[model samples]
Target chain A: AQSVTQLDSQVPVFEEAPVELRCNYSSSVSVYLFWYVQYPNQGLQLLLKYLSGSTLVKGINGFEAEFNKSQTSFHLRKPSVHISDTAEYFCAVSVSGTYKYIFGTGTRLKVLA
Target chain B: GAGVSQSPRYKVAKRGQDVALRCDPISGHVSLFWYQQALGQGPEFLTYFQNEAQLDKSGLPSDRFFAERPEGSVSTLKIQRTQQEDSAVYLCASSFLAGAGELFFGEGSRLTVL
Candidate 1:
C-alpha cells in the first residue's frame, strides 16, 4: 500500500519569510507526487506535480519542490511567502498506473503579517 | 459552469437517514472521481469512474456508500442510513485524461449527520 506522511500539523511563519513543508512517502512501486493548496471555504487546487524528468518542479506563486529519490521525500519550498499564501497544503501520492491519490494529514500554513 | 459543480453545498441529516449528493463534471471529461475530506484532514479517494464504467471502487469504505455515473457526465453519491462517521465533505473532481492528469475539484458538499 502507498501512504504519504506530512509530519507538521501546522506551520507559522512571518510574511516575506522562507518556508518549507515536508512530505515523505512509502511505496513499493513507482509513484507520482503532487501538491495541492486549499484556501478557506474553497476547493483544493493544484500547485504542482512531479511526473518525471527534472526533480526540481516549480509551481505557481513562486513555489517549488525538490524530489529526492534517496530520501523518498518531495518537500515544497518558497523563497519568500506572502500573507495570501497562507492555506492548507496537502501532499498526495499516486501509483504509476492508477489515478488513486493517497493524501497526507495536511499542513496548515499560517503567514503572520 | 466551466468547472466542476456540486449540488447542495451544505447538507444536514439525522442519523440513519439517507442522503444523496450530486456532482456535475466539466464538459467532455473522461475521468471522474469522488473523495471524502474530513475536517482538518486531507481528502481520501472513494471511487473513480472512466466514462460510464466504474474502473476503480476499491477505495469505497463500505457497501453503504454507493456512487454511479450513468451518462459519464453527472454522478451521484448516495449514503444509506448515514452514520456520524459519514459526516464529511464530499468532493468531486474530473480530468480530461483517462487515468493520470491534473484534477479540477468542486467546492464540495458538506454533510453533517446529527
Candidate 2:
C-alpha cells in the first residue's frame, strides 16, 4: 500500500514571499508523485509530477517540487507567491503500473497581499 | 467538451434518499475515476473504470455506493440510502490511460445529505 502525508495543514505567506509545503510518502515499490492545486469552488489542477529522472520538477504558475528518494519526501516550493496562489494544495502518490492514487489530507496556502 | 464535465453541480438530499451524480469524460479518454472529497480534505479515490469495464472499486466506502460507466464515455455514481456522513463533493476525473500522464478533473458535484 502507498500513502502520502502532507505535514502542514495551513501556511500563510505575504505576497511575493517564498513558500514551501512539505510532503512525505511511504511506498513499497517505485512510486509516482504529484502536486495538485484547487481553487475555492473549482476542481483540482495538476501542479507537477515526479516520475523518473531529475529530482527537481517545475510546474505551472512558477511552482516546483523536488523529489528526495532517500528521505521519502516530495516537497512543493515556490520562490515567490502571489495573492492568486491562495488555494488548497494536495500531495498524491501512486505505485508504478497501478491505477490507484492515494492523496494526503491537504494544505491550505494563503497569500496575503 | 474540452474538459471533463459533471452534471448537477449541487445536490441536496434528505437522509435515506437516493442520489445520482453524472460525469462526462473528455472525448477519447480511456480511463475514468471517481473520488469523494470531504470538507477541507483532499479527494479520496472511490472507483475507476477502463472504458466500460470497472477495474478498481476498492476505495468505495460502502456497498450503498455504486458507480457505473455504461458506454465508456459517460459515467454515473449512485448512492442509495444516503446518510449525513455521505455528504461530500464527488469529483470525476479522466485520463488517456493510467501512466505518467496527468488526469483532468471535473468541477465536481457537491452533495449535501441532511
Candidate 3:
C-alpha cells in the first residue's frame, strides 16, 4: 500500500514571501509525486509533478517541488506568493507501475496581504 | 476542448433515497476515475475504469455504491440507501490510456444526505 503525509495542516505567509509545504510518502515501489491546488468552490488543478526526470520540477502558477527519493519527500515551494495563492494544496503519490494515486490530507495555504 | 464535466452540481437526498451522479470525460480519454472528498479533506479514490471496463473498485465504501461507464465516454455513479456519511463531494477524473498522463478533474457533485 502507498500513503502520503503532509506535515503541515495550515501555513500562513505574508504576501511576496516564500512558502514551503512539506510532504512525505511511503511506498514499496517506485512512485510519482504530484502537487495539486484547489481554490474555493473549484476542482483541484495540478500544480506540479515529479515523474522520472529532474528532481526539481516546475509547475504552473510559479510553483515547484523537489523530489527526494532517499528521503521519500516531495515538498512544494514557491519563491513569492500572492494573496490569490491562498488555497488548499495536496500532495499525492502513485506507484510507478500503477495508476492509483494516494493523496495527503491537505495543507491550507493562507497568503495574507 | 471541453474538460471533464459532472452534472447536478449539487444534490439533496433523503436518507433512504437513491441518487445518481454523472460524469462526461474528455473526448478520447481512455481512463476514468471516481473519488469522494469530504469537507476539508482531499479526494479519495472510489473506483477506476479503463475504457468501458471497471478495472478497480477496491476503494468503494460499500456495495450500495456503484459506478458504470457503459460506452467508455460518459460515466455514472449511483448510490442507494444514502447515509449521512455519504454526504460528500463526488469528483470525476480522466486521463489518457497509456496510464502515464495527468488526470483532469471535474468541479464535482456535492451530495447532501438528509
Candidate 4:
C-alpha cells in the first residue's frame, strides 16, 4: 500500500517571504510524486511532477519541489510568495504501472500581506 | 472548454434521495477519474475509467455509489439513497495518457446531503 503524509495543516507566511510545504510518502516500490494547488472554489491544478530523473522539479507560479528518495520526501518550495499564492497544496504519489494516485490530507498556505 | 467539465456545480439533496452528477472529459482524453473530497481534506479516489471501460472501482465507499462512462467521453456518477456522509466535493479529472500523466480537473460538483 502507498500513502502520502503532509504534516502541516496550515502555514501562515508574510508576503515576499519564502515558504516550504513538506510531504512524505511510504511505498514499497518506486513511485512518482506530484504537487497540486487548489484555489478557492477551483479545481486542483498540477504544480510539478517527479516521474524519473532530475530530483529538482520546477512548476508554474515559481514553485518548485525536490524528490528525496532516501528520505521518502518531496517538499515544495518558493523563493517568495504573494497574497495570490495562498491556496491549498496537495501531495500525491503513484507507481509506474499502477496509476492509482494517493494524496495527502493537504496543506493550507495563507500568505499575509 | 479546454479543460474537464462537470455539471451541477452545487447539489443539495435530502437524505435517501438519488442524485446524478455528470462529467465531460476533455476531447480525446483516454483516462478519466472520480474523487471525493471532504471539507479540509484531500481528494479520495472513487473510481476510474479508460475510455468506456471501467477498470478500477476499489475506492468506492459503498454500493450506493456508482459511476459509468457509457460513450467513453461523458461519465455519470449515480448515488442511490444519498446519505449525509456523502456530502463532499466530487471531482472529475481526465488525462490523455493511459497511465499517470498530467491530469486536467474540473471545478467539481459540490454535493450536500442533508
Candidate 5:
C-alpha cells in the first residue's frame, strides 16, 4: 500500500518571505507525485506534477517542488508569497498501474502580511 | 463545459435520506474521478471511470456509496442512508488521459447530513 505524510499541519510565513511545505511518501512501486492547492470554498487545483524527467517541477502561481527520490520527499517551495497564496496544500501519490491517488492530510498555509 | 462542474453545490439531508450528486466533466475528457474531502483533510479517492467503464471503485467507503458514469460524460454518486460521518465535500475531477495526467476539479458538492 502507498501512503503520504505531510510533516506540517500548518505553515505560517510573513509576506515576501520564503516558505517550504514538507511532504514524504512510501510506496513499493514506481509512483507519480503531485501538489495541489485549494482556496476557500473551492476545489483543488493542480500546482505541479512529477511524472518523468526534471526532478524540479515548476507550477502555477510561482510555486515549485523538487522530487527527491532518495529522501522520499516532494517539498513545495516559494521564494516569496502573497496573502492570496494562503490556501490548503496537499501532496498526493499515484502508483504506476493504479488509477487512484493517495493523499496526505494537508498543510494550511497562512501568508501573514 | 469549459471545466468540470458539479451540481447542487450545497445539500442538506436528513441522516437517513438518500442523496444524489452529479458531475459534468470537461468536454473530450476520457477519465472522471470522485473524491471526498472532510473538513481540514485532503481529498480521498472514491471512484474512477474511464468513459462509461468504471475501472476502479475500491476507494468507496461502503456499499451505501454508489457511483456511475453511464454515458461517460456525466457521472452521479448516490449515497443511501446517509450518516453524519458522510458529511463532507464531494469533489468531481476529469482528465483527458488516464493513468498519468492532471485532473481538473469542480468546486465540489458540500453535503451536510443532520
Candidate 6:
C-alpha cells in the first residue's frame, strides 16, 4: 500500500509572493507522483506529474514541483501567486505497477490580495 | 462530453435508505476509478475498473458499498443501508491507461445522509 502526507493543512500568502506546499509519500515499490488542484465546487485539475526523468516538473499556472526520491518528497512551488490561485491542492501517489492512487490530506492555499 | 460526468450532483438520503451514483467516463477511456472525499480531506480510492473488468476493490470501506462498470463506459456505485458516516462526496475519475498517465475527474456527487 502507498500513502501520502501533506505537512501543511493550510497556507496563506500575499499576492505576488512565492509559496511552497510540502508533500511526502511512502511506498514499498516505485511510484508515480502527481499534484492536483480543486477549485470551489469543481473537479480536480492536474497541476503536474513526476513519472520519470527530470526531477523538476513544470505544471500549468506557473507552478512546478521537484521530485526528491531520496527524501521521498514532491513539493509544489510557485514563484509568484495571484488571488485566483487560491484553491485546495492535493498530492497523490500511484504504485508503479497499479492504477490505484493514494492522496494526501490536502493543503488549502489562500492567496490574499 | 469532454470530461468525466457524474449524475445527481447532490443527493440527500435518509439513514437506512439506499442510493446510487452514476459516472460516465470519457469516450475510449480504458480505466475508471471511484473515490470518497470527506470534508477537509483528500479523495480516497474506493474501486477501479479496467475496461469491463473490476481490477481492484480493496479500498471499499465495507460490503455495503458496491460498484460496477457494466459496459465499460458508464459506472455505478451503490450504497445499501446508508449511514451518517457515508455522507461525503463521491468522486469519479478516468484515465486513458493505468499508469504514468493523467486522470480526469468529475465534479463529484455529494451525498448527505440524515
Between prediction 2 and prediction 3, the one with superior lDDT is 2
Lowest summed lDDT across 10 adjacent residues in model 4 chain A is found at A94-103
Question: Model 3, B40-71: lDDT tens per residue?
Answer: 88899999999999999999999999999999
lDDT of 3 by residue, A41-60 (tens): 88888888888979999999
Q: Between which residue pairs do clashes occur in model 5?
A: none
Task: Determine the iRMS, in angstroms, of model 3.
Answer: 1.5
lDDT of 4 by residue, B31-113 (tens): 99999999999999999999999999998999999999999999999999999999999999999884459888999999999
| lDDT (Cα, tens digit) per residue for candidate 2, span A13-88 | 9999999999999987899999999999899999999999999999999999999999999999999999999999
lDDT of 4 by residue, A1-113 (tens): 89999999999999999999999999999998999999999999999999988999999999999999999999999999999999999999988767688999999999998
- What DockQ, between 0 and 1, does each candidate earn? 0.70, 0.77, 0.65, 0.76, 0.77, 0.84
Docking class of 1: medium
lDDT measured at residue B48 in model 5 versus the true structure, 0 to 100: 91
Q: In model 1, where do residues sit more than 4 Å from their true spots? A: none
lDDT of 1 at A100: 81
TM-score of 3: 0.98
Please give, as one word, the docking class of candidate 2. Answer: medium
Our tally of clashes for model 3 stands at 0
Better of 1 and 6 by TM-score: 6
For model 1, report DockQ.
0.70
Which run of 10 residues does model 5 chain B get worst, by summed lDDT?
A: B95-104
- Candidate 6 local lDDT, B1-114, one digit each (tens): 999999999999999999999999999999999999999999988999999899899989999999999999999999999999999999999999887789999999999999
Candidate 6: regions farther than 4 A off? none
Q: Score chain A of each prediction against the true chain A by TM-score and list the results.
A: 0.98, 0.98, 0.98, 0.98, 0.98, 0.98
Q: Which 10-residue window in model 2 chain A sums to the lowest lDDT? A: A94-103
